[model samples]
Target: MKPATAAKKLGIYLPAAPQDFQDSEVTRAEFNQLQQNPPEWLAELRRNGPHPRPVVAQKLGISISGLARGGVTEPLTTADITTLLAEPPKWLVAERSTHAAVRKQDLIAKKLHSESPKN
Candidate 1:
């Protein structure tokens, strides 16, 4: 599979992966092995990685746009994400509230849509 696809499956950030991993292609066997029984390196990467934006947002409990607004342009390691969550800044706090509001609105909208008559 492609590097990006592999990284996504592994829940890792491609740019932060090792050089060899970045350069090589992941065969089906390798992918399956990684899923079934990841090696030490793979385990380490998943545990403390430069996680992708979606994962980062999920970990931070904010939207991806929130990360952008908070000026987090680069991928963050698990440690960095942990620290941010542990000590949320003003922007993060504000964004989390905004995100929560947006999610609530979305839920309301979905309910309204479901209740509406079919056209």
Candidate 2:
């Protein structure tokens, strides 16, 4: 797989990865190995991340749009994310509620769909 694909799967920002990792393709076996037992660099990146937008959004329990609305245009480290979670701003609080409501609606829709007759 491409380095970007590998990085996306690993959930780290691609540019933050080492040059070698950015330069090379990752074999399926290597990808699996990395997931099962990450090297120190990968582990450190994951643990103390300048994480990608998707990761930041997931960590914050909000959508990418919510992040944009909150004016978070850049990647954020774990400490940054921790701070946001600990002392959520008004925007973050509002976004979380919106996210929860969307999730609830999604669950209800799925339940209704499942209970309906299938073609």
**Per-model TM values vs. the true structure:** 0.87, 0.96
Question: Lowest lDDT 10-mer window, candidate 2?
Answer: 41-50
Q: Model 1: how far is 12 from its true place, Å? A: 0.3
Which digits, one per residue and each the tens of the lDDT, describe model 1 over residues 5-97?
999988988887778888889999999988999888878888898788988999898999999999999999999988998999999999999
| TM-score of candidate 2 relative to the true fold | 0.96
Q: Write the per-residue lDDT of candidate 2 for residues 1-119, one digit (tens) a residue.
A: 99999999999999999999999999999999999999999999999989999999999999999999999999999999999999999999999999999999999999999999988
Report the error of model 1 at residue 53, Å: 1.6
Number of the top lDDT candidate: 2
- lDDT score of model 1? 0.90
**Model 2: runs farther than 4 Å from truth?**
none
Most accurate candidate by TM-score: 2
